[model samples]
Target chain A: MSKKNEIIVIGDYTVTQLEKLSEEFQTIFVNKTDDLRSLSAASRKNIKGVAFKGHRPLEFDAASFDLLPELRIISNFGVGYDGIDIQEAIRRGIKITNTPDVLNDDVADVAIGMLIALSRNFLNGVNWIKSGEWGKSGEMALNRTVSGKKAGIVGLGRIGCAIAHRLSGFKMNIHYYSRSEKSSAKDWKFHNDPVSLAEEVDFLFIALVGGQETSQFVSKEV
Target chain B: MSKKNEIIVIGDYTVTQLEKLSEEFQTIFVNKTDDLRSLSAASRKNIKGVAFKGHRPLEFDAASFDLLPELRIISNFGVGYDGIDIQEAIRRGIKITNTPDVLNDDVADVAIGMLIALSRNFLNGVNWIKSGEWGKSGEMALNRTVSGKKAGIVGLGRIGCAIAHRLSGFKMNIHYYSRSEKSSAKDWKFHNDPVSLAEEVDFLFIALVGGQETSQFVSKEV
Candidate 1:
């Protein structure tokens, strides 16, 4: 195979994604990130790049990187790259790329969508109409409105900012908690802590990136 | 009963609303608009005002209005007053009051909510998780995104304007069909007719008031 075709896909990819990638390159599939360790040293030496996309945590620390000597880069499918050890990747001169801001619009759309869904009881409303209760039992119980309510975002990153922008259209009072106050978030109240953000808002959205740094950030107190 | 206490409630009212009105005034309840014909002339003479609320069309034209000689006002419970004949009410020196702008926020919220729900297939996504299909079937089918899509409003009325304002947050390209272009809709593309508006948009919102004039505004062609 040509050097350009020698790529290893290490992660759980959907069947469609897997099929597309497999057809276009000399791709080696591995179910988990650490499965590269089981590959023979000669076979691993041919791997020039890694395409990783999975829901689980990737074990691509120093030990894992040492397994593929010829690997030049690790391209992550999602925005968050907390799974990979950035420090170790930098020391070994391997480039790390993540798809950032690509899903910001989508994530924000879902955040606002879920807020309205929960407040409006859309699922229950659908069930009410489908089960013939709308005609037999009259209208469904009145649901709370999403407009003019207060919403707080835990981490005002790209996704959080997108959500806040969308909430503004609903005439909602926007509040947020972030490591430092963002200059872009004009007129939106900023809280120094998550608990404070949680206290004064009708809905709290956690937009923090996943990892040890933010795993327990929104504790039981919040 | 005092003159102020004499009120007739026409059309369907919730149990709570009926109880509250009954507690405060000498109120006669009629199940529908035409049921006013059943009231005795003596009983109708005591009715100074009418509280109207129903899902069906109100038959409160000249013939129906003449039944209650003492009727001074018809207070509609909702924003739409298409069912009541405004010209007839004016000729009889009777006032027609509707609760307009009261539901602008709520109607706007549901408009955007239903948009997101349909585009993202939220109900199916919820069922996927609830039916253990998320674990068994992996991920559900990918859904279309709402942000940046073209949306057309059939009428640029109060409720349509509210829906348009909310759609702006989703980064949608707003196109609207109105009788006349609105000064308030800054930069939103205006179409002179519904068919022209429908041709260019992904989602079409029928926000026109329900009545003979606009009953078939969005016809088979659209």
Candidate 2:
């Protein structure tokens, strides 16, 4: 039922990279402003994959996907597949893949940076210098320490391990809660549950795969 | 000169922890306020091994530390050591330690988060929701894919390595710049200068030691 393998890019992206990516797959850039009918009509003509379905929330449910039997896989652009209906995809025997681990450091870095910014008012201090507050007040004032504190990370995986390695330099007692414990890691302590991990740490980090498993994991405990 | 070995906490802290720490090191608490002179005078008299200097920047200049021979070490409470005169302390042979790796995960998270925030307008989107712009608007927009982007880090040390490791999850091409080169790390591409590193990546991170070699490392090129 296939003439040529078709792939769609559903978000805004650099044309340069898009051109390069097109060599591997047939590409279409469909953003918020896209026409679903055109997308559906295109899918009917032997299109096999939707590479960026989760870029925006789904406009079509499982019923719409059933109309086009050509759709075989939905390659998610990011780790969080909240926008996609997992049950619907699973029912249809459609394969779903997320670009995980790839963005771990970026996301983890952003998360930790945000923590520091919030705890010590780092952004406010930077704003002070930019907005001429430093000239007026002489300084932005002192900030909180980032060391000698309990650091807790949830979903200790690749990104979590990387974070723990970095946290080691800070002399923080690292605590983690995962579905399966890494008994191999003898250096850091582990809590039986998320509540215990949250309670033990002064700084709590959420670094787990997001799906049905880890949605609102931190919301309950931390 | 000697009574009981008194420990000093030279900043605002939770008294519960201090009481616990005092049992180990003769704890003393000195509140840092607007008066800098009194802050230094009070801290100078103490012979505490670990001084948790808070709010006010560490008050002693290098010469002033010379007057207090009993002081052993200054354990900084936070990440940025701007308040302490590190060079002067080095000259006097005083052991100055900082909480470095502790905040690495948190700070790296924030750095990447900020990049995403700035790039995607995550805060603006949140602001839109809080400002009641979400429902009123036809569609809500957030930032783009964090994965598969080029990331360049300055100073490939503990924090820098943490940032790189986290970003590695997103499948980004990670590059670094350090004074000396290493041959063992096959994954990380090393650049010789800051300008070269900045030129390569979509996101730029500054995680270097602040001293003679790195004060203005990520200069205007950013």
- State how far residue A198 of model 1 sits from its true place (Å): 2.5
Give the per-residue lDDT of model 1 (tens digit) for A1-222: 564487889888889998888787778899887788788898898787999875555467788888888889998888877678889888989999998988889889987888888899998998898999988988899889889999999999888999999999999999999999989888899999889889999999999987787777878999
Best lDDT goes to which candidate? 1
- Residue A173, candidate 2: C-alpha displacement in angstroms: 2.0
TM-score of chain A of each: 0.87, 0.75
Candidate 1 segments whose C-alpha is farther than 4 A from its true place: A1-5, A14-29, A37-40, B1-5, B14-43
Q: Worst lDDT window (10 residues) for model 1 chain B?
A: B54-63
Tell me the tens digit of each residue's lDDT in model 2 across A1-222.
Answer: 444456766665557767866877777666632443466564555767876644545544675576457778877766777667788888889888987667655565456546555776755765787899777776566666665578998878888886776566445688888887797667888877888888878988877765566667667546
Superposed on all Cα atoms, the candidates' RMSDs to the truth, in angstroms, are 3.1, 8.3
lDDT of 2 at A77: 63
Please give the lDDT score at residue B113 for candidate 2.
54
Candidate 1's TM-score: 0.88
For all candidates, state DockQ relative to the true structure: 0.77, 0.17
